[model samples]
Target chain A: MTAVATACPPAVRQGGGPVPVVSEGPALLAGIAQGPGLAAHLNRLGPAPRPSLGALVDMARDVDLRGRGGAGFPFATKLSAAARRRAVVVVNASEGEPGSHKDAALISCAPHVVLDGAAAVARALRTQEVHIVVSSEHPSLRRVVEKALRERVTAGECLDLRLHDAAPRFVAGQAQAVLQLLAGRENLPVTAWQPEAVSGHRGRPTLLSNAETFAQIGHLVRVGSAGYAAHGTAGEPGTTLVTLRGDGWAPEVREVAHGTPLADLLDEAETSRPLLLGGYHGTWLRPAQLRGMTVSRSAIAAAGATLGAGVMLPLAQGRCPLVRTAELVEYLAGQSARRCGPCLNGLPAMAEAVRALVHGEGSVRRVEELCGLVVRRGACAHPDGTARLVASMMQRFPAEVQAHSVGTCRRGREVSG
Target chain B: MSEHQLRVDWPACKGHGLCAELLPEVISLDEWGYPIVHEPVKGEVLAMARRAVKACPTLALRLTLPA
Candidate 1:
């Protein structure tokens, strides 16, 4: 670990000793919100340690740092891959997933923590070129990040950071699409599957990950591996932010330790209705299946579901899940990049078939067949994800499928859709 | 000689279904008329699979061993 000369700009404790705004967690979100400047962050966490590449890689592996983005790929592996033939590091803060605000929350509320992490990773990789990709939907977020970049620059830290505004589309947040967007090309996945770490933006080896992952890297630097591991479970250590959304309540981004019960975060004793784990490309779990689950990735994997990018929303009791499923499928269908025939033709066809079912005029067999055809047939996993959501809807709620099939709802009333 | 798998360059394929027509034994059109390689092209079908790749209008189909 190397400590550079400090120009931390007079530690004044911005809001009188960092009162936690969004969350009061054991890690990252601890003292996240500040009033206006970097004084509070500098005073609280001190300057983030500029660990050498070897040290950062070892620390990442020791603390089990996984990308906070949807895929949750190992950060150490990504770093090591980037070490060879890599020059660029991209901070993906697009936060395009529906009902997901955790990354956006980090960028808006705690910009320094994210910026510090990016600096650490970029410096360790021995490259100063860092690009931050953000969606234009949140002008305020862009403003906040811009302010943070200036603060880091004033602090005499040198990481040539450039922020690019991107369209707020679902696929726009994807790693490949991000590379293309940065290059001023169309934001869509290419037919070829080139590992971004090997050949990324400008055809150089690039280290691209979710914005929150870099924030966690900052946390990992402040509190070394052991301190970082203090909060979460042994298998998956450290705290993670979850954006909780439901029918009655407005969305809230809460930072909780890994291995916390999924039910506990839902703020309910137990829900009888189904839940959507991960984001749209995630899984649908029946109440019984989700009851025993924790936030640990391995635990979720043990049950054959990925705890993807952490968007938890339970279907309200009164609402028909199939109706929601149909709506979600249509949304996902519209999100397809339209690069391939299977996704282009299959998604719209699947959407129509699902819409027909919701309106009481399609077969379960037909929907299943469409799901069968669309899986693994795209440039990206968009079609497969949409199909998985549909399949899970069918599996989790058989009675709902039956009711809609006979031109009636689960309540035995006429299917009103 | 190395064995190669029949594959589709997803973003390029326009669903012309010519690959399906030329190599029906290995490639078949799905409900959407997109080619789905049912099995690996081997022995007897290898020659036909090469012809199918050459026949694709958009040059979207490939017969290459995956790396």
Candidate 2:
């Protein structure tokens, strides 16, 4: 609703890509070597009474952890205010952002690590049902995760986790939309209801957080807040898993310490051009400003954007910013569930405007009007966020936008032909 | 909140308009015949909201509380 940007706070720019070696904590590798998760891990912890809602709150607070899910809400506060005891735990594994491969990659590589996190949180919250919500694209991930949970049962791990197939549409990955589909309703719904936290399953409480967040939770528990806080910035501690895609980069999942500099990650990717931070729903940063830009959620927010889902994409110099930005906007629009009045009506209109700009056939008036309609009107941030991204591109890359406008850009070539 | 709201899945609405007839104070039909409920529901409207919800001939209308 309001464009708010805070000036620089704490920041860090580090080397290495995602999956940076976590030097502290209980050693996730140790847990991995035990070769027993769910049940074995539970057995190892042994009869530890589930932390009181209060105790769990304290741990979350002590760690200063935030939602690894894009919002970055304080985990402690989310736990405290969320419906307690009766809440359902939804592990978001949709991995819908084209630039985002972190969730699926994590589950594929270390299924048990994620499971340990899910189990720990559910146990801590005393929730009986844990749903693993994944997309149809990653069928193996679903099967493997399910099989891993099954194995945990043999080791006496509490087996309350269920694998749910969420509609693979991009909009379905939004937190509320994901819940609606899990409720056995259409993936696209007009209203927002709390399924996992409120009236979940048979109308109980629900705690829906992303798969990565749960993995972080698992790390926090094994290492304790103090150990987990050892890496990264003081304001933002621990490791972050990001999906690194684009030029000169090893296209793989990476683990980096929190507050790693954006410049460093791009250097790891070897990207020589501008970078698109935060995925399609994220912002595009020019090469010059990359220096000293940190990766913490707050730091990015201060820069008027976020590192959503920790997605890092690079746009080479030869690539036209206008074309790339337009394509991404249209891609995001097509992903909308078309439930709300604004998303359904607004997105397509914005898409057309972007297309016209791409072809050098758009008017400034049309673009401005479409952008205005895209905010605060959807069940999720898909429409609003996409609009912001496109609008920001238009604002920040004025030279490119003007080039397209005056028929001197790539879009003008088609017109001349 | 005495006044309540009625929502229809536009795809499911089928333009039944039963809610409009059953609860005029809250609902009005659109040009195409779909029901548009304009009344803001409050605490006291829960009973009426429930009635309207049940009365929808197509079962498209629902009464929901904010979380």
Candidate 1, A53-75: lDDT as tens digits: 99999999998889988888999
Off by over 4 Å in 1: A1-21, A246-248, A411-413, B42-51
Error of 2 at B33 (Å): 14
Lowest lDDT 10-mer window, candidate 2 chain A? A4-13
For this target, which candidate reaches the highest DockQ against the unseen true structure?
1
Residue pairs in collision within model 1: none
RMSD of 1: 6.0
The residue-by-residue lDDT of candidate 2 on A82-137, one tens digit each, is 54657677888886776676676556545566777777777767776788887766
lDDT top scorer: 1
Q: How is the predicted docking of candidate 2 categorized under the CAPRI scheme?
A: incorrect
Question: Every model's DockQ, to 2 decimals?
Answer: 0.82, 0.13
lDDT of 1 at A71: 83
State in Å the error of residue A202, model 2.
4.1
